[model samples]
Target: MSKKSFTLSKIATLCAVALSTSAFAEQAKDKDIERVSVYGQHHKNYITEQADSASKLGITIKETPQSISVVSRALMDDFSLDDINAVLESTPGVTVEQIETDRTYFKARGFDITNFQVDGLGIPQDGGDVHGTLDTSIYDRIEIVRGANGIMTGAGTPAATVNMVLKKPTYTTQASASASVGSWNKNRLEVDVSGALTDNHAMRAVVTKQRSDSYLDRYATDLTLGYIAYEGQLTDSTKVSVNYIRQSKDADSPLWGALPLFYDDGTATDFDVSTSTAADWSYWNNDNEHIFVELEQSLGTSWFIRARYAHMTNEQDSELFYVYGTPSAETGLGLTGYASEYDYKDQQNLYDLYATGDFSLFGQTHNLVFGVSSADMNYQDSSLYDYTTGNGFPAMPPLEDFEGNAPIPTLEDAYNGSKVEADQKSAYASARFKITEPLAILAGGRYTEWDSEGLSYGNSKVNSSEEFIPYIGAVYDFAENYTVYASYTETFAPQSEQDQTGMALDPITGESKELGIKAQLLDGQLFATFAIFDALQDGIALPDTALSTPDNTVYYAAEGINSDGYELELSGRLTDDLSASFSYSHVDIEAGDDANEGKLVRDYTPEDQVKVALNYQVPVIEGLSFGANYRWQAKTSRVQSNGTIPTVTTQGAYGLLDLVATYQVTERISATFNVNNVTDEKYLHSLYWAQGYYGAPRHYAFSINWQL
Candidate 1:
């Protein structure tokens, strides 16, 4: 059988097995099958009760002393937020910078969010950018902790940390299938099967598969996800669990970079929303595999010893086309094409051994947690470029008549780019103490060692760093349902950008401080917070024009970059039949004492933003519900040099509106209809780069789901 056929066959077999088990479960005694509650997994709730992305203490969000936001599964389903970018866009205080169709960067509080975790395990990248799509089908919810997370993530930026919690198998057998059809010839199908594979509910498995087309020109994707877990009660005091996960994504005709927004004469260029720079043969593919093992032993009722080990691997392969240089507004005759092929692989092994217990100290019962965690990661990548052209790169046709018909260059004999190898290691520990009934304190520190040596485009690079980061926070409950919190944390981020001397810049180091008040209302179902934050960063890399490289890239360290911001957010159920999430944020960023002092920092990020979403159930019509989401941002501007002249690119303030309606067709069937960008707004997707793309116009999708 073909590879595609084999993949489909595996999905079908898993679905069949789940269906059969579900049927058998229906006949089994109700007491024999453990009933798992779906309130935290699939229910229509906007807020979760607890989060530990900032601190590994597994504390409640109200006690974490940081700005925390959660994107629940129900929200993703209602809005059809199948991609990570969409999910983060819905979150407060986060900016999704879509530089290309497949490449993206996330920022918060004037800094890049480089820390990302899967179920509390770190998944650090070389840079603060994401290369491939991260589907939300297999995730239960996403937790976003804003500010420095040095206690948990070690060396990283201070913007935020994202923790994606994956869906786990239930004790009882279940299966779900969905199909969707949308605008722009978009089509999607998804299947999920999860349940216990053993009678005792010890062995469980979750399998998911999704395939979809895009609204962009010449873009399509296919995804396959699988998860298996085994949990057992070895004795009265000892428990063990093991899990494995595999996910793969294959994208066709994905854009390597976006379109240039300016012409050679310093005039802005305009294009339709469907315009794409990708050649027909361009593609990007990636695969991720993970393994996890844990053992827990109870020393007493209030203490436990746990050990965890995780191994993960990420691999990517792609052949891409990049369009560079600006075309003339009249003739459109200056563009060129570069063809390249890339292979990348990253592997990580993590280990943790921790112990937690309550101890009596100073006549007060305080909680103490002492542990150590170590993570070792290795990265390797290589590239092959087409150097067969006489003028250095293949020239493209006029923009007025250009289609994705650029020549596919032969890359076998003209390869010039080659290998790279990098490694990172870290160890960390944290603790939480309860000083009194109304006050708590959290403190922790991390030590990290990182080194990288590589060759790229005939340039040899080597860099290494060793640093220790510290964290502290305090929470005080002054009222019945209200608390005041403060936190201080530091950040460390490595850079690969080179200065004018062709030497790698020093790592960035920063400090963050936050003061906030949190409240829980409506019987602890509603969550609200208002916070003011300030951060100072040093050794920030900035483009330097005094000197230039062959590739037109040069950077210098900018010191004393300050970011000041405030945010207000509300999330949770307002009434028994109504749920809402709302947020507003304002930020000001500037260079304090550098050569660029008093200048705006990363002005591409908006100064003010708002996001609102609400869902309501109709009382008059049973099984019918409606949801609406709106997002708005203030004007943003960036200065870019076109050839030898400086120019400005600006995007005025704009808002997008989306609506969804759902109805229950049967007890086990439901239908949902969604319309996004209801106003058909025409706007640039991002301004992070000089080259940009337009956001999708009005689009609609209808989906039907069946579950058992």
Candidate 2:
């Protein structure tokens, strides 16, 4: 079907379901065989006992056959996680890598996470070039579902999906404020006020700002974030809500790349954690604005329909300097500089409509959900400065005492990029069938159409239409508080990847299978999940070795890669005085599929990783609490390119420790202290094009929270 027809079909189908239900409302009696909640309220704690990210059916953690993690606001506050990156570090089975100070990458199960949602509405996050752009203060919780999410989100990977649930306006009056100070002259302030504006209307707004000097020399940051929301109850069973967000971030003298890996003598150079590759004249600034609106109507007591739409715009401008090449210990003559100034803007429109309700067949109760979603993204005019003309700057500079106060050069407009338009539309349906009191089966599918064209100096060469992805799962509660389940899901993603012959390759498809056991212990306070999964990425273009040419023009054929892993996690309150969130992840990925140059390591992802955190409320004291977090990862290895720069780098394994303490000063006031990298262990944070980015050294921050 065409893109428009695809979306229209979804809406038509969902509306049909609603109409049929309404028609049969009088004839059918309420025989509730299964009672489930779609989106339930969360309690105040560092852990969420249940979530619905993995399954739209609102299945409990013990019932969903997947690896899912929920980062609650209380957990974020306990860990002082002000940003996405910090919260991700505390989450299980996830890894974050920094390409620069702004652009970042997140990986799970040896694949990239290309799917993101807010309140179940797919957000068009095109790419996560900047990872920590989202503010945690504006969110109620973050849901991370590992493996494929094709059942709910279309055109993605089997890696994972991140769903950020925004904070809503409370009908009750609430207000809070916080102030913080930390090392490197870092300071932050935040204010949040929410209450009922009228009997049927409520409003909430959040304002937060942070300014800090970095551990790296010449690097500083100023960030401001704001969110405002209003909700109105039109009728007893109808509600409408709207929210807007504005985020502005400015990083002064941010690092475009990382420290040089090699010295003039061809030996690797190691620098202190305070080392910086940013020039004093470099800065990266970004502004993001988004508006979201949602409408909900209750079809009946057992069913509901929700419609949502969002518009987002992002603007970024940067004058960055990349300092590369290792300096010689004897001459310090190998450092080089590359400068660039660019402006880019992106805007997207997102829409989704869905309905969910319960039905009865053969004396058993079941649930059905149908939805339609579409996202259209447009790239406005963009410009980049030309650099091939000349450097005109020192190719070799002192690395140790490099203080870049050089005059900023005027920028010349290069090629003005063409307006790029991309869109994805999909229709999806899912159902849960209860075969027995303790056994249930879940199935879903999505049909999607994708299109893209008019890119910078390039046009759309590959697209897809009428592609259907399938999802299936089975859950059985063999005993009380224990469940065993398995699931299989698939996704399709169109790629711009070209073969060696410069021909655009076909799209990549991912299929994942998972089997797990979940347990609820300590009277439902402790939740633990153990899962084993294997995922395959197929339809990837691989070079044909038989017809290979040295000029890089070779025929290509489809190939497949396999990745399997094990995940074990435990979350929730261990005891009244103690709580913990921890997990261990291990993945084995293999590529090549016996084609071309043979199978080798496909990614730089670590094969083994473990994360543990504990929060203890002092039983002896009224308002004293302490916690610590630790993370360990195996070595990360990547193969260098062939030709003039063939080499290999295998970073050693490392572990990090963090500590936190909080004291209650009054009924509404509290103090907190957080120390990151408590052991001061230096490790590799990320790698980009053979460059190494080091982790930060020891740092401490103190803050105060007041609520009224």
Candidate 3:
């Protein structure tokens, strides 16, 4: 069937499901009351005994007026999520491009998302050119807040923010262990244990180990993670907690090159198909270690305070090979062959301290937060060449016969090196006020200072920059079960002196204005939200000169603008036999110059995207359940060698189907089977230029869990 026909058919099916309720209602009535209360509420209520963690902390999710998605621990376990990409791939408005087995780039709302947090404390989003992959075993939940978040996260783009809540010590004792095996010789083991050591002391620990022989030839990976935490009640109204986490991974191969593009006339080029350009490759590995401490104190009637401190370090060392072509002595034109080798090393460290408090003024509530942070990051790169007959090139002959003999060059003849260092400091605060029983308002702001130094090829440069951002939002409860909200927010990106001339360029900032309605249906068992938004970024800085020069690279500057169409959503069964959640987003983006000249934006985004997932438990089988997810995205642009070519787009809107079943063989033991990409669609999860990597094919995994 045609793409349009398939899309329409899928839409029809979804509409039908939304309109029909006879089967859903009937099945829901048969479930036990215990399960009903767990899934019935559309919006969480403060009076509930089992309130959500965020709600218990007095955080309002529905009234935030921002696009956010929360992935609960229950959902993670159900899906057997092993990596950050796996968990985020099913979320709306988020896309990921994996450069290698362990490295990935994330985008949201048509822009790169470079803000991340652990337990509400900010962390480096781009860990550097080296891939920064975190093990998912230690997280309790993940939250994604979209749009300009500088008010809460300091300095960053308006794209989106990701905050990971770590596992904490609990008052109750519990332990669980799981082991799994899958296609491509994949195997994994995870264990979690938590309990109270004394009346006022609690502790928890998590450990994971995984190994995989990838679907691609010569690709393999091994990973390990360990986490531990302790919590203690210092006084009747004060609590303190500390945590430590470490992760490491080893890979046999890293992606260094991409698929060849077409020739000048658009005809495709066929490079070697068998002779591998990657030779004797391996990574000494990368490691991440973190330590954090938090203190919470509650003052009588209407005041509370929270203080937190954290330290983190990342280290990496690796060797890589590149491919190039050799020229024939007769024709002068070269034949394609292997290239050179490079050795790289890097280390980064970050420190953060923050405090927040909640108090009542007159008869209303207010929240205030502030923080300071610093980073010391470093990078080093070196290169070497080969002089042997075929030292640099692959040891094996080319896939096809070649008629040329080319001498390899010496390492000392061609070499380059560089070093970079950066430091940052920031402060921020926010407040929420309940103007009336049915109306609330929120406002906040932040300021950040940054400095960077670089030394490359014996030349050094230094730069510094600073910025401030602000935001405001309000919500009005129209009825017992409905509310309306609107918000405006601004974000800024700093300019570096080394990169930006001393011209005092204004910070690139934007405003997001939105209006939306929310409903609480099914006796509070289900919550639904819909919103419309118009977001605009003004005074965007652009390159000044279009031409390149020998001595100075021509840098230009201009004010650019972008406007977006936005939507937000949330849904689930509060008291039904089956529960589910879904989200969708549509954005219309455009760019304009200071003179109002309009141009189509390219290479960084797609105009439309959708993500959906459904999970249901069988009424007859106590431990049996099923779940599936589907994602679709419209094509975007890419930069090519010949100016800008719109030919290379992502794998045009693909669907992934998954199936899972779990059975309890004993009180302490259970087994699960998961089948991913069941249809085996050959598509790309991400695309860069004309070279696209294929998504994982059909795979099957089975896991066993034991509780003690």
Candidate 4:
């Protein structure tokens, strides 16, 4: 069937389900089932008690047949992790590729993570690059589910899924404020206020604001965030919640692209950590707004139905400067520059409905959940550029003398542009059945109708018409504290990238298999897991260096790729006053089932990585605590050819250490000091592209906070 036909049919099905909810509720009155509350813990801890990101069924992380990781509020506070990039860097088996000052990419298991969510609602990423900043001030915790999550996200890569859980309003009033001073003239101030607005505590709100400067030359950031929610009992058996979120970012002197890593002599170039390619006039601004509504009604005494709606919009505007071309080691004369203007905006509307309950089947109690969701998005972008011929960009000085003083380029001419519309509709159902007292099985599948009508770089985008992805998993409790499990799932990703002929590449398809064991130790205060995963994908897009288009866009397509890896993680309170987290990850990626079989792939990502975090309350001091975070990675290298002569830039194995100390000055006041990159190690920020930039040097931050 055609994509339009399938979409129409799916819409009809969803409509039928929506209309039949009343009838189903009536029928549920006669059924004998157990009532279950799908709620998680309310307090902060080093480990999460329950998470639904992997299944949306509200199950314990230990019982779920997948590898799960959590960055808890306590951990974030201990490390002073106020940004998404910093949070991901401390996550296990995850890589943060900061290719430029303003753009970043996240990867897990050697694949880019394109799927993300707020709470349990999916929000597809705009592209591989993350533009602007993602602050963590509004989030309560972050849940990461490793491997394919096709059951929750219908279409995406086999990488992990990141779910940011928002901070809910409190029934009681709470307020906090902090001021920070850091290295390189960096200073920041933040304020958070949350409380109930009504006598019954039905209406609540949370508001936060932050402003900060950066370590890089001419860089600064400002942020404002707000959230309001209303939750009240409409009737004895029904409830409703309405929420709104707003966030904005204004940044100055953010680089659009990275600096050249090599010289014309096939040798690596050296630059200070403070070096930047940003022009004094460059700036990036972003805004995001969201509104969500949910209604839940109880059916009889056991079943409950939920319906949700969300609308979100994001906007970005920027004027950026990029420096390219390898300079001469002797004369520093080969470098050139370009200035560009970008304006883009997108909006999405999503709807979801589901029901959950426990029913008796085959003389045993079982859990069932089913849902339908629809998402629609529309977006458009425009780009303009300015460059020079015999010299650097119009106002750019020589490479050696560059200091971000160039004049802003005129952006009157439209060089490239795109407008696109995308829609996805999915129906999914999953159930957990008790085969025995110690064994349970999960089975489910999702049917998706995906459609895209758009033009990018003057070429039509292509996507799959329809797909049905299956999911299955099993868990067996061999002991009171240990359980072994396995899971299998598949995923599909549509490609917007073009081939040599400017035609969109075929969609990528992949499947993942994972086997793991989970254990609870130290009287269940600590959680440990070990897992092995294997995944294979076809039609992955790789840069085709042998070909290029008139627009300077590189073509790409790799037939087959395979990845296998193992990870071990342990997290929680080692003692009453000591909390810690540790992880070790190793993965190998290679070409598969093609002429390039056995060739290594994604060498830019390290094959081995280790991370450790610890926080300890001082036994001798009444109000003092100490914490540390350390990360180490194996050597990573990338090969770039300088006119047929291959040159390799290698960042040797390295480790970074960060220390934190916090002291409670009074009942309502505290002070914190943080030191990062204690050894001041110098290294490349990332090798995702041929060009690269330097990472930050040693930095320190001190903050004073007061709470009520």
Candidate 5:
């Protein structure tokens, strides 16, 4: 037989096998059945389809009018993702900027996203730093709802909202354990157990421990997490559940300093400083705990109610090291070495109580949700020691500097000082009207009051004024697979006084308006969305002009406006031998206002970003599978401290490819290997203030798991 003929025959056989396997998988999915209990109703139903329950609860991507995406547990397990950042990498319309090892910022729809929830409960945005550092082991699934979530989460940005759903216990007893070892001496272990304690009671528990000596020398991390849950059927018409989670981490990584942009000749890139700085040393320790309870009951055939209460506390402590030096005489500071230390502690306590009910009005179903919540945040910061050293500096010196031994003036000697204390309170309500089977409208608002006080180095006392913010939105479904939405949302940030006059200023507020279209297809297996938004702040608070020192240390007394363009997507599938998912986003973000004469723009956000991944099982090998991912982003500019001419701090569009393969030896044993950045691409994951933080170099990992 000719070679071409042989190849054709082989291809035909492979296609036939693929078709047969797909048909069998579809048949199995159609045959499998499970009993489902409907919340807010006393009805028992059989779920013969994989996505039936999600559809019935109006939780499917197609049913939601707003742009929405779901990342299931099956996908997470297949990718071996361990943290929120890794999980978000596979979600469309989301982009994460790692400020440091412990701090990260994320943006959606060309705007900073500050709205987040756990099981539909609101989580205040203190900043974008801590949100990305959260662990993903505690969540069974993640839901991304784009555009303004004010109607559901109250006060927040119109960018987007992320909700994490925790795993619950089932009637069958099950347990699984996983252990892995990776590059840079990284190691991780996790265990999950769930079962029924009694015929009517269920319990679930999870524990995760991780330790790693990161790619950067002297940088290390250790983390421990635990979660426990209990659920019970109080009666045929009622059900209750409680959950608790605790997480803690210890990390040591410097807040690396930025490099200079020009030489003495005022030409860019004339001076080259060390890309790696060892003089800076820092550490972060944080602990978070949350307790929540939920209850659902059916009052009658047409009435149902759901009540929920949750309390959460988060505490964090960290120290940063600032370095001053020069690599060349023309551009550098011309100093051998100089260092300063800053320390801070932040604590937040939150309590939430809410109830929702469904009732029939005028032959139409009305969903009403009303609730009150309060949050208290305390922040304390102090400058421990500030000293300047020259030439040969000791390695890893303690923060405290002795008076006589210190070459430069100490913090106490200079009499230079620091500041402290800020707090806030808020309350809100929202409702949704099912105007018709194919249409729904939602509206809501929130009120926030805040106060702050602090003292500067020159014996100056500063205070801030209070403010109130409101938000509104609407969602219209044209069909099961398409939706159109629009919204107006607002957010606020406190501003400091100009001088020591003890005078206060009104808070800087932002207002955003958005319109978008969403689509879900393949029986809720694929999702896509497109949105256009414009946001403006009438009186944005920026740094004061007069008090500009060399380092640009000024108060927030200026004004500005910001506008953006955005697009997003989320898609995936579950199959017997192959599973895959992909996400891509593009955003154009720009800022303008009277503060900096509408000329200076921020440094971090990029215009175009893309992420894609695929996992395929070996057809000939029963237990082996392979997976790969690619990520890319376009160039973006960085702004100087003076908010003047922008610097060409481009990262250059680049992609990182990863590969992973897993083999199962038995039903209870499996081994896996993963290689990140397989192409050894030289790129920077983030760049700030003209300084670059390199992406993780090519690395490999191996893992073994056992289940019983």
Candidate 6:
């Protein structure tokens, strides 16, 4: 809102990148830091010292060749990030799209982000972004790798892999609780406790409840979440752990779609930001449950083995309403009503077994990993109904003098008996070889077998065998604290639908080449990466109805898809009193075919995007902190025209600013105050055919925490 906000003198605002790393190096000289394990590592405002998602082995940020971002627990607590969607919004180069209030999609680098993992185990996410509502209270941190990950993910794209690291039980006793109040009558209460149960046993538990009314009239939500984890050492070399989580949500008067952008008369509909497009009877409900277990054992000398398994279940039910078709220009008399009901259930099982150790090769120590993994997903029978003119004929209500009251009609058994099941199994291996003191090479591959068979209106089946994916990379450190690396990886995506003749199409294939420079400055307190990537995907699937099979599938493969992009990012504690994260990304994408060559791959993806966040602690006042966040994206639009509901719209460039202030009232008591959308700028959050969503206006929240 003001130019002065962006103005800054060289010393006060700029990150002191030139400041000495000598202090951190000095501290390292006197202490031995534990290796970063996926199990347990904690830091408030610091970057991850070591991570495994990049190469499936513990390595520092600079050792890996790709772009990665980590959002730590301290950052989440400072900003009150309670869900996965909030985490994604803060991560650079990632975008969240809301199809409606209940469904969301995540996008990155011109592709849909389809791979999600928790604690290094890969689980199948429900199609169409059903997992977007996952709660993040049980996680210690989130890791994002911005490139192809054929070594870990048996199938899927190279867009990115998001890993959620759960907080494990600690040997020392710890506990905390918080109460929060925010704009729109939102209230939240949360508690977490963890400690030792016995000499070699530990337990942890967490519970949270939140209720809130939205900015729109008659829209409100209620949620309850719970988690428990137990870990124990059975013997000198054996350990085991188990964890569980559950979430339940209920909402009132949630809209099935965004507000209409144009009236029937080819004129834009002017609605206030607080306008409601929902009926009083519309509702959405979701329930989720997850169970996970792990076992680890040490074999005599230099080898260890581990096994992990997880089961997840998600259930949803909804009754939604929307107004469709054209309306009268004079009195807004003509309009049609669209309403639907659905009951859906989804379940998944994931298992992985792996071993890590060192072996002598050519008079040098080398690392190797061998593992097998499998995943199965089942979508149980679903029920659905479309009620248009029965028991509520004239369901097509007039829009003029509209009343929010719409009769909740009974739904018929129009359920098509929907069902789907998919299975995948793979064996993978990788090794890191030390060529010399300053250079190392990495190589790996996986062979996968997958099958998908289901009944969707009719029976359908597809299967693939011997899908081989490969990964290769090399890193060379020519100078201290800096490393240059290059990597190449490939992925395969099996096509699910069959052709008209009941034959499955070939699996889509993708490859990526990336070169980057990574550096850990300020004695590893800072992680920075500058990288450029080129991705090419062939066999893009396009439907062919002419060859319809007995099951009536119009599935066919397209030619190619290509995207090239560059990313620059910095994350970690810049200094003892200052911590910040900043990122910038730019890209261009197009299809391989001449017909669609020059156009962007995805219409709404921004050509330029930037995200910056800073946290500053006052040197004079202990336990007091101040933070600010800013986000910007270039203009984007959607084009739509239909004889029934014709319209055209565009959203211009927009920026947002949010601020936070925290004060430690006492040794055990602290409070945080946040003001989001500080500028109160009006902008479009998302746009789709026939409808569009408006971004939230300024909002504020206050939270106080107590611990013992």
Candidate with maximal TM-score: 2
Report the Cα lDDT for candidate 6: 0.74
- Evaluate all candidate structures by whole-model CA lDDT and list the values in order: 0.78, 0.77, 0.61, 0.79, 0.59, 0.74
Q: Which scores better on lDDT, 2 or 5?
A: 2
TM-score for all predictions?
Answer: 0.88, 0.92, 0.82, 0.92, 0.78, 0.89
- Residue 464 shift from truth in candidate 1, angstroms: 3.0
Clashes in model 2: which pairs? none
lDDT of 3: 0.61
Backbone clash count, each prediction separately: 0, 0, 20, 0, 0, 4
Highest lDDT: which candidate? Answer: 4
RMSD score of candidate 5 (Å): 14.3
Please report, as a residue range, the 10-residue window in candidate 4 with the lowest summed lDDT.
35-44
In model 3, how many backbone clashes occur? 20
lDDT of 3 by residue, 268-387 (tens): 344432222333453446777888888876544333446667777666665544434332323323324444455556555555444434445566545444444556666676655554
- Which clashing pairs does model 4 show? none
| lDDT tens digits by residue: candidate 6, 1-708 | 222232213221221222122132232233332235331122255345455777665566566777788887777888777888778888888877766667777767766677888888874353426432767888988888887888888887767888898889999999999999999999999999999999999999999899999886678899999999999999988999999999998888876776666666677666677666677888889898889999988654555568889998888887777766655556555655666676778888998877665555565566667677888888865545555546332344444344567766666646666688888777678877879988988888877777777776564655554588988988899888788999999978777666655677788788988899987677766767888998877776565657765645586677777778898888777777788888898877777554142243455777788988888989999989899888888877665564766556667888888899999999999999999899998876665334766777999999999989
* Deviation (Å) of 55 in candidate 1: 1.5
True-vs-predicted CA distance for residue 169, candidate 3, Å: 1.1
Rank list by TM-score:
2, 4, 6, 1, 3, 5
Off by over 4 Å in 6: 1-34, 37-46, 126-128, 263-270, 326-335, 386-403, 458-461, 545-553, 594-601, 643-648, 688-690
For model 6, what is the error of residue 527's alpha carbon versus the real structure, in angstroms, after optimal superposition? 2.0
**Could you tell me how far off, in angstroms, the CA of residue 94 lies in candidate 3 after the best superposition?**
0.7
What is the lDDT for 203 in model 6?
95
Model 3 stretches with alpha carbons more than 4 Å out = 1-57, 124-132, 261-277, 280-284, 323-355, 370-390, 393-418, 456-461, 497-507, 536-547, 561-563, 593-604, 637-639, 642-650
Ranking by lDDT: 4, 1, 2, 6, 3, 5
Error in Å for residue 641 of model 3: 2.6
